[model samples]
Target chain A: MSCAKPLSWETLVDWWAADLDEAGTSSVEEHLLGCDVCSAVARRVAATAEALRSMVPPVVRPEQLAEMFRRGVRILENPIAPGQTCDFHFPKNADLAVHVLGGLALAPGASVEVTLRSLASGTVLGHVEDAPFDAQRGAVYLACQRDYAQLDHDLVAEVRVGKDRPAARYTILHHW
Target chain B: MLSASDTVVPSRWYRLGSMMTEATDSALLAAIAAGGAGRREAERALCRRYAPRIRLYGLRHLRDEDRGRDLVQTVLLGVLEASREGRVREPEQLVRFVLGTCRNAVLRLRELEGRAQPATDEVLVAAAGGEAPRDPVNAAVLLRCLGSLGDRARRVLELSFHEELESEEVATRLALSRGNVRVIRHRALAALRACLDAPARGAA
Candidate 1:
């Protein structure tokens, strides 16, 4: 059964601190949006939480914060070029695989050039001259055998689908 | 509000790349003012640079971790919206603009909470007025008080906040009864509050 009672201040603080499960958090958020009394309590609790957090500044690292920002920005910044989109999932015990997504219209065996470049300097880091499309996935894979330790900088993959098609650039953010 | 799962393609990666290098505060501001992909990239770069600081502000004022994150989103979006709408007069003074936004955000939060005045610690240091009360708590004093707590108390706080573990999980790990865990957490926070709000150690 769902909790009918107003959540205690401690529970509210815990929710605010993200010390709750996803379901608990969602329920609390939904309740807070509607309950004025709880909202007021949360504001005060938030002040206390802030004080405690400020006292412990190192709780969240700079890189973690940057990564969160990067993720949030990804939501705001739309991909300008037209192509299929796919998420990057690194598999253990496999070569570094960069999936360059292309439009669904791209047929199987469609030739493409995948050029990886440094985001900061625009210097070419690697290139695959003739990677064919996996039409099922509508993407091209650029497998790199270099030591993973050597790939730490933010990069962009410029994928030219065909001779006349516009090159679609994909951001490859390096997460630590 | 594009979910990463929904749109995996790069919308503004090139701009993100170029903006990473040689973009001054003014140049970033200009990019934000230009709108579209330029604006999005600038927003990303700015968030990456300032979100931590803003989160700290949220923690100090809002006193909640989730609220601190919300504060980052609120402040950044507000600043970007203001910039995009051509409201920022001094594009070069981006730092000042951000500080002002933060101040306004804190002040607005107070208003929302029905507080007619700023919280004691939130007294505007730059305001021209009578003596502002010393903040009830300072980081150094709080840290010192935190260290004074027993190891168990410290661990509970760490596990609860840093590890983001539930009380039940924390109890399981610590081998304490769930009820005892709650008691310890309550007593620990109370002790900390009392210590932090206490008068300076040697004030005559």
Candidate 2:
């Protein structure tokens, strides 16, 4: 059997994986009948693509969103131990409002910084530093403005242990 | 004039032009330009339309859901600020701008953590696919084939397929003409098909 061109075996595999139409299927059938190397490459690519498609993570939940907000509020209200990081998840379309409560473990005169960043574009939405931290009642009150609400990206709130490293990172969904 | 069934299908470019007409981005841009009530409505529409896609894109890049969401919010605000300043004129431009920003953000995070090789292709493949191939040898071959694509082509494929953007939207955001976008997309798809079908041809 004569082939039109000596298409590389690798190229053929790429074509087969991408092609879903009749022409592509027929071409593959013809190639398989005439070439052994191409057939193996095709099978491998298909299997791998299939395997990769299955690993996407499931969606976030409301409870996770509430917890993430609560944790962010906590970190902003109290000082966290250096090197300790918290991860909080946000559910889609949940309110962005958060309330901080006072806790006895927080130290007096400790300041909190709330930095909101986008996970998609890695942009900083808002960064408020030296926000008053009241250790007395173990609570600080702060409101997430709608200014950050227009974003279509996922948000990450990083509460630094001090001025250096993060004490906790909370994910919040911005819904307008 | 032709009957509906007999009429030639509109070209991708034509479809894209029409899509652009109703695009939320365009409306947002107009609202931003107009200011006031129109601006508020456009901004809201922008948030509704792009937020989920942005979140998903962020998740894919950052591998952390919370971080991705935060990034989406920040990018949107930045876009709004730029719009307010008359810096951005087109909604399609926002997509590229956001993705470019995302790339930078991920790089910064990696640097801050001092982690070399942020994440492996295997991890992305796994994240994209799920459970590692039951057969390691076959998986390795597949990875090699995907790696063969040039970075630009790979990115185009991801933006078109993974991001689920229409061809015209992809073209507009990428600043390419619609025809060019279709061609590139076609070539990329062809490449993927070739890579997958190579084994069968070899066997022949």
Candidate 3:
């Protein structure tokens, strides 16, 4: 309760809450252990800190996120050209989510659908809704949610449309 | 469309590391403010450093790894977007901005999850030290003490501890005189101690 700088228990509380450096924090801890008033203050401060932290949710790793950004940039730079078909294999452990950004030219009536079919059992996961293709900067954003946590199976994405038959297939390598 | 020119990777990625290493925080802020390639590079670097922390913070709050990861990604993306839009003014304010955004995101997630009570206090205490005191009764009493403080005092305390803001900044932002801030902060602490000391306070 009594300090040189007219400091109060709140100051100690604040110090404890803020995760201050060792020196300041240690001093605050010392005070809390010795002074009943400060100890009480520390308890409240600690509680408040806990409450605030709980209110916030957890977030993902930076490396994984950086990879996602890199993928986005890659898609923007080199999309599937009109006549070229590229096949990508989703690993059994990977749940891929693709986003297709429609280009300017595919405005009127050009449509594209990406179907994911299991090669072994011919089981269909689902079809991704695609917009009309544009000449300027059309893109198909594709994301596959593979149940890697469950079964290990190779899934192929079949690109189907009228007249343009540039088909590509990828083998899913299941890790888990 | 698939020519070599289109395939050529931008030289910006190679330059990014050096720029990040050499640039001051202010310089990075300036580059971000300028927008274009420089902004992208700056954002990438920022994401690299702070994203992990954000994820860890999120994990502590959400208690779900996948959800936490999503929140981290969302927070970084939001920060990048804000930077692109010229909403962020100072580089030093980045932590505050990220933390505030994370707080809001968690609140929304809680609403979606239908969990009313937020465990921020418990999270903070655990984060502060590896081991909390073994006495649950005392811990509960302490929490009650914190609840007794007024909103402003609580805010100041939370900001000071959780966000690690300096007292001077807290006073300035809260528009309170430094002396008054100090006094209120002190009183709040004292009141908490009194509450903790009272018999059966934890039960209450």
TM-score of candidate 2 to 2 decimals? 0.27
**Chain B TM-score, all predictions listed:** 0.47, 0.42, 0.47
Interface RMSD of each: 15.3, 17.0, 15.0
Top candidate on DockQ is 3
What tens digits encode model 3's per-residue C-alpha lDDT throughout B1-204? 576655555554566767774565556667777887676567656665554455545544565555665566666666767876778766666666766777788787777874333333332223223322212333234434555667687666655544557677878988997667666665665565566557364344
lDDT of 2 at A81: 31
lDDT per residue for candidate 1 within A113-144, as digits (tens), equals 76667778987655555544556655554432
For model 1, the stretches where C-alpha displacement exceeds 4 angstroms are A1-6, A17-24, A35-37, A54-176, B1-137, B163-169, B199-204
Judge candidate 3 at residue B166 and give its lDDT. Answer: 69
Query: Which candidate, 2 or 3, has the higher DockQ?
Result: 3
Candidate 3's displacement at residue A58, Å, is 28
Q: Among these predicted structures, which one has the highest TM-score?
A: 1
Candidate 3 segments whose C-alpha is farther than 4 A from its true place = A1-176, B1-13, B114-204
For candidate 2, lDDT tens digit of each residue in A1-176?
23455445444433433433556544554444333344344444433333333211111123443455675532222223323332323334433434342232456556666565677887764554554444554444434333333333365656553565544655544344
For B67-145, candidate 1 gives per-residue lDDT tens digits of 5555566667777678778777887666667666766877777677632232222111111122111233554455556
Query: Which candidate leads in lDDT?
Result: 1
